[model samples]
Target: MKRTRRRKFPPCGRVGKWASKHSRSGKHMKTKTGKKYWLFHALSILLILMLVALMCLNRGNPDFQNYSNFYWDKDDFLKRQHEMGFFWLTRLGRLLNLTYEQFYTAITGLGLFSLIAWFYRYSKYPALALAFYMVFPFLLDIVQLRNFLVMGIALWAFSLLMEAKEEPTYRYLSLSLLLLAGTIHNTAFIYIPFWLVLQWPSIWVILSSGLAFTVSLLIPRFLTEASLAQSSSHVLQRYAYLFRGQVSLPGRIFFISLSLALCLAVYFIQYSLDQDRLLEAGVKPKAFQSLSQLAKKLSYLSFGLMPLFFQSVDFFRIFRNFLPLYWLLFSIYFLVPLKAQHKRLEKLVLSLFLLGILCVTCYVLLIFSNTDNVIRTVFKENILLRLIELRGQ
Candidate 1:
């Protein structure tokens, strides 16, 4: 093979040289990106652990129902499994089962890990993302809500979906997981539509949302009948405390106006910002940034609307139902491009965020103190329920 010894390859002399150069450049880029991602993940995990720890420490004893009382629910579900129960436990237990004492510990550890994973997978600044998620008002208010377990599960599933490379298989799996999670709690239903919008935007989402709206319009009737049926037999006097709260229209109008104003302001500001940075960020800011920004601002402003919503409508009793939407929408801003024209503006924004956090902490403490009970209520009487008038009359 050396007989003709093609002239010794020289730099820039052959196509091979160009290919080699390109490969090296690509590898370098990959390495740099990988380093940044790992650093972000580590910081996210550290921040998440710290925040979770703070949440645990400051979890005040509020007068509310607790999840510990659900032993009967779990036991009943197990009993109904019959012959399938032991086999399911042996097999499924290997996957999800820990002893009773290990239950909460497992949930906490798994949740913390899932949270860290989600930050890394979702946000470029993972640490900041986790901090924001932790500080979210709804999350702060519903620390003891067992229904949120579904959300935790869905979050983990979403993380996996984000990382998955395949198309149809992963998308289907994610949907199935989302639906199963939704079944765990009515609030989980929000995730389903959101997932559809993110995944199958072509057909499924619009149809599903429209169908869902129609179905939602019918649910009250069905639920009312179910409540009446159960009232005769249930010792807790089913729906005994229904329709107990009211809010004035003037208050609703005020909140809606405030939310709309905030939305308009953010949209206008974001629309006037630089297009280059926005485009480079993989976000179509030049085209849809204004609308997205408005939606985000409105979502945050919607938190303030919950108090108003509860005051206005007796049927929309679960304000927490909208919370995930609030958090999810607000998180979109982190992906948007911001000029931060001056250090002062940046500092002002940072200060405002910090002030918001401080206010939330104080509010948490005030709510806890205002509660007329000793032990931390895990369920029916927790901050979220009372805030939504879901408490017994």
Candidate 2:
């Protein structure tokens, strides 16, 4: 009988209003996210354009002169380098009747585009990844055109592998890309082992990394030994020649400490994930776990191989190779999750971490500025203005 008036209760009305509000907020959030995605790409394209202009117009640099020779003297190019991929690309450019500037622009643009595209698709913070790139390897890569191209291909392959780790098609494609990259630069072959190491169990990964570190510690001793220098293997001799330079004790310590700090940050992120801290912050546990695991593996690999930094400044490239992944980890784990949790201690840690990165960036800038002719070449008058002046002349 009382069914005559199932009253429209205030609570039910309030619940309906709350549900509507929540839905509207969710839609707003999605719209915001979509805008952010496009904005990121727009900025990325601008950055690529800026970098390409800077690199292509930097004609006075020693590296530029050396690379220019590759376009004119095929025989000398082939004789000086075993890698044939860039040579073939030059041939293609010649067939197209492209000038050296056009060819260099195409190659540099393609490489930078691939790297930035990968970051946009996979990284939680593409901007941060780009920032990391700028602070560490951008200066070096701008000059080392071939290596930069190889790095792009290698990273693209890595992105594919990560996307579909178990898919045979992706594996083959990634392998092919890597092989192509190796043809461009033999150092790309180094990633094959790194890729394999990523698939190991955590315990095995740790043990292998420890073993690598131990072996790396002995590298200094091996370098000093006469037998290594006298070895018949050309590869050993080449590496020995490359690794001949010694880093100062303080410099070595600083690099080792930086590596350790990265590894520790990864460990802390992983620990937080294990404790479900991120899950409590509304993160998808599975995705974050996968990322944390990947980050941990990469960090371990970096830590294991870090002693090479002590052997040669060139070894900095090795660490730089891994920086994109590190930035990805830091963005997703340390930046997003920690910030979302709104905990004071986590915020403090984030601030400290950022400060450390700023300091490291300054140090890198100091080193880069001190590099022979970098400031003169990089900070010179704008290339566009210089071209206008030349035309006016």
Candidate 3:
């Protein structure tokens, strides 16, 4: 009877073995994941093509303008433009006797390849991320902006820095990359605070101060005098208009209140998180608690909101540039407590969030499209005409 006995395998084990064998045979079918991967890639390619077409069709158009020419147009940008390290690159490339086509090809090729590499390395949905990058206004117009290549480098450096905390080598690489980026264009300076936030808090103030000092010294030399003259005039007028701008009393109050509430919420959340960490670490929580308390007190700073006289206010402009506020808002949404703990409820919440993001993105594209069209019309009607008029004058 024992010799005649046959061993039976469990159904689950049989399926597991079968599936494993099937996978090894290269006919492994993950219907869901495969479909998603293909779809993501297709969408990415489509988006990139659409963006390229859009840029190409409008390249000569005035709305898009010729921002790339800023570096080469000596009379227009002059000494001021040199402060941007890009001018140095352009000069070096020229000095090397490289043809214009050769230099351009090299820069654009590197920028694009780097971006593709970034997506491949970092994105869970690489295809979707690539699609986002293609259509983003910053990227779409980047090739036309001489500094955009450098900006891309800077952004990539920042992205690397985001993940480089544990790896000291990468941190140094990021610093070097950022320094190069700053040389190419100083806009990387805007992100220094965020970078500092990811670093040791003890050194944050000193590092920031040093960065500021470095920029103050290096930026002035390459300052595009031409652009600066224009930027200053525009900035000043914009400020004046913002501050003096007429706003409905209700609208003004609503936005100001909203801004204040948002800032306070962010400060409190951050403070709470810090306090929680300190408590968990079994450190003397009193000092940490006191600091958190101060942050909460300072959260009341929002109450000092002055009227947006005409919208040109420097304070308002500065406030408008505070992109970190959105990060806080996004964090709050994720932190929302759900009454129901059902799997279905969790799925529903995730789906709704994704849908909302899609809707918002569509709306933004529609707005940008409208603006692009308007810019095209204005450029067609008067860009050359304006130039002629200026010459006549």
lDDT of candidates 1 onward, in order: 0.45, 0.67, 0.45
Ranking by TM-score: 2, 3, 1
Q: Write the per-residue lDDT of candidate 1 for residues 1-393, one digit (tens) a residue.
A: 558757865676677878989999999977975775577568766876565544332323341123332322333443223223223333443456544224444454555565455444433554544555555432433454334455566655553454345354766777777676555444455565465454443244445545554565454444443465456444223333442345566646644543454444345445544566544333344223423432343234344335435443422323333333333323434444465657447545644654453345334433444344422343333334455564455
Residues 40-73, model 3: lDDT tens digits: 6687677555543333323243323343354345
Listed in order, each prediction's TM-score against the native is 0.51, 0.78, 0.51
Instruction: Show the lowest summed lDDT stretch of 10 residues, model 2.
Output: 273-282
Clashing pairs in 2: none
Candidate 2 whole-model C-alpha lDDT, 0 to 1: 0.67
Q: How many clashes (backbone atoms < 3 Å, residues ≥3 apart in a chain or on different chains) does model 1 have? A: 7
lDDT of 3 at 33: 42
Per-residue lDDT of 119 in model 1: 43
Q: Total clashing residue pairs per candidate? A: 7, 0, 21
lDDT of 3: 0.45
